[model samples]
Target: MLRWVILAVVVVVLAAGSTLLMNLSTSPGTSWNLPVTPAKAGPMPKAVVEGELTHEFGEMGQQQTGKKSWKLTNEGDADLQIWKGTSTCMCTVAKLQKEGDKLTLKPGESTDIDIEWKTNFVTGDFHKGANIETNDPDHPTFPLFVHGKINPPVVVIPGDTIDLGAINSDEPKTVFVAVYSPDRPETKITEINTSKPDYFKTDVESMSASELESGGLKAGNKINLHVQPGFPLGTMREEIVIHTDHPLRPEIKLTVVGSVSGPISVVPDRLRMVTVKSKEGASGEVRLLVRGGKEAHFDVAQKPEKLEVSVEPIDPVGAKGRYLMKVSVPKGTAPGLIDGEILLKSDLPGVAELKVPVSFLVGAN
Candidate 1:
């Protein structure tokens, strides 16, 4: 009975030892402890943009200055970080407060992003944009827009220039331009002035509300400009200045363009006497033609020295205002280049005086 009980105890002890060695071999000397719950999941970071996302710079003119701003708020449980910002145009600038690359904003906190644009680089209508990079998962990037049309404070209708097309010097021509400011309604045109008052004259009248509304002018005045290309004509270019009540833009400048056509134009307006001898001078003749084959009355203003001028009516009376002007350069004239002008008076009201240039190059005799 003692041997049997000893044998059973030895068997149980050996079994328990074998089970412990098997567990150690499988786990390689590892130990087990109480299970740990994972840390509670937290809310993610987010951003809420407020204020203006887009701005309009109305009627921005040359070198005009303006600015716009927007607010950025951190509405998340974690910190809001603004990484950087970029602009589409070098003319536009974006600004923000510095907090390193990790610009931090606590919950419910906000910051401003200032954007400025100058009209010096743009004309007519323009549009621009900017992007702000942030850490917010919802909005990793924020976008902004800027747009508007450009016009000077003293704005001109039909544009900043007047193209009068082709005009005859023998007839009076007039152009109407509306000068006003849609951007500045309070301003008024104080005085209308022209650079060439003789050639380009201006008359102003109070623009009625109906006229203003019809012409799309919110406020300002209208100018009735009279242009007379005068004699000795070709392409004409002039300028008209407008004085305003505004302090900043006290004067507005505009271009005037036109071409002068003559009623009785000469074939060769300039008489060239190239390579002439001292004893025997050069002579030239010019034919005058009327615009519509009508009669034209003209008389010489002053007879040039060392030259004889005569006019003969066209033969057979086939054409009116058609005449032959014969210019005779006398002999024994001094050698050298001779620069002179032929003056003539006409019955035409628009063309009071006409000047024809004469150039003589007398060779050494």
Candidate 2:
């Protein structure tokens, strides 16, 4: 009986060991395979809310204010949550609609976001940016750009060039260029400058502060450019640069050309008088007499309390197109070259003025 009992105990022990081995090899929870290290996370797949977007619109006239639409879509596999969307200015606004929960995007599905910007305030080349945030782990945030251009309703009637008829150097004259725009309510003139400062001056008569505040100039609205001629004489060519809020016509160039009369040819075209003595005056003359163009005119105008200037003409009436001018500097002038302009008014419209530099030497005879 003792031997049988010992044998039975040994058998039970063997059975128990076998079952433990089987469980260790075949059980899902007991497998001896090494733990797998998780893969390195990749960059997010969020694309530009909209791919390569652009827009265009008509001028915002009083009656016909036009608008354009820009759309943004998500192309990623996961849901794209727009944390924020904003514009460069108050003229633009963006909106997104919700259909249901889950942020609603299946693989390859897309949603649209509408962007409406007021074209009334925007003219010329326009660039606006929007910021977007997403749930994409790799790229959580991105930028969306909407680019476009606008043309004002007004057309530059004289186009690029204007020729004002001639006049005497002693006389002052004004010329007008007409600007036509059908959409005048939304347009404004931003800036105006001249290429030749001494030869002419310009003013905008039609554009108002209220129009500028409202938007800018539009079509059918007329822009009157008043150009004033300066004194002295010879051939004159200059440019008027006008800047507006219009997107397509931001910068406009107007040309001014004419001729003046004088003798004493001076190379280098312009003069710079420097280092004049305090109690003495200096003189410089340029002889530019070319026949075939309009007759030349010459004059001298002085500025600052201490300086006096005179332009002495060699001929009273220039020989059709040729004449001479002598610049006279007087006593008690300041030490530096007295700076002023010799303006020559011409007989031609828009081309009526020519500017010459007048300089006086200081501390020199």
Candidate 3:
């Protein structure tokens, strides 16, 4: 009986030692108390899109669109959920070959997604991408890029829009822009004209070697926009049309925008109030300040019925050239957009009248 007892003790000790050694040999943090049968991986979704992640459409026209189709498959044992995701500007996903907004692909199942991009929005070597969202744990979102050279034939470096910024109605300013052709170096500008000849003058010059290199073209011209003095006050946006000899694009339009100010100016040039509770209504304030050591007295020349306007000196005696103009929407005003102008008459020099565009939206909270 004693020998048997000793033998049983030895066997128990050996079993304990084997378990400790097994736990030590296994990965760190692994437990020895798990179930007898090892746990197997559960069913999970997988998202896979076949082919190269990027495709180049080569050189194409500005107005033309580039399209491509991709095949997405579910190689996993579970169902896959796919939906459209955000895409870059000027790029969109066409109606899927599949019929639903969200698609379900079983094991070994596949679907096709069509993507289209507009080249006219940009020029030169352009790269745009779109995203595909899925329920796959491995790949929650997949990204694909479309590459192509946009042949605007005539390319404008640094955009065609020139913002003159804040210019005194009496001050003259000048801006220059570059226009060239990546396809042909000998492109010529036949004629250039400004919509408002009274305020703008145009001239063309041969682009320097460095300018041409920076424009990524061998030939092009630089345009000088001379903004003359005494233009109308308030916001000024003018168009300068350039007639080019390019057969594809006969003309290019440029825009010059800026605010022209007189001695008197109003802060919050445009007053806007949105989501105003119709029951309570709302109002906005505009600060009128007269520069150049001058004073201005304001009166409401004209206003819409939906609006109530009032003018008050910022400080009746201490402040000399500043006032507060308040435009309000009455409590009972209808629930819609109130788009109107508040014509103001001020005593400031050279500004016969001032128009302030006011927009208010009244809604039920």
Point to the candidate with the largest lDDT. 3
Model 2, C-alpha of 209: deviation from truth (Å): 34
Between candidates 2 and 3, the TM-score winner = 3
Q: Which residue pairs does candidate 1 place in steric collision?
A: none
The local distance difference test score of each candidate is 0.74, 0.54, 0.80
Candidate 2 segments exceeding 4 Å error: 1-80, 85-112, 118-123, 138-143, 157-178, 182-255, 261-272, 275-280, 286-326, 335-337, 341-357, 361-365
Quote the positional error of residue 259 for candidate 2 in Å: 2.0
Clashes of each: 0, 62, 0
Assess every candidate by TM-score: 0.58, 0.44, 0.50
**Minimal lDDT window, size 10, model 1:** 91-100
The reply for model 1, stretches above 4 Å from the true place, is 1-43, 56-67, 89-102, 116-121, 166-171, 190-196, 227-236, 245-249, 259-263, 266-286, 290-350, 354-365
lDDT of 3 by residue, 184-210 (tens): 668899999898787788899999989
The alpha-carbon deviation from the true structure for residue 276 of candidate 3, after best TM-score superposition, in angstroms, is 2.5
**Could you give me the TM-score of model 2 versus the true structure?**
0.44
**Who wins the TM-score comparison?**
1
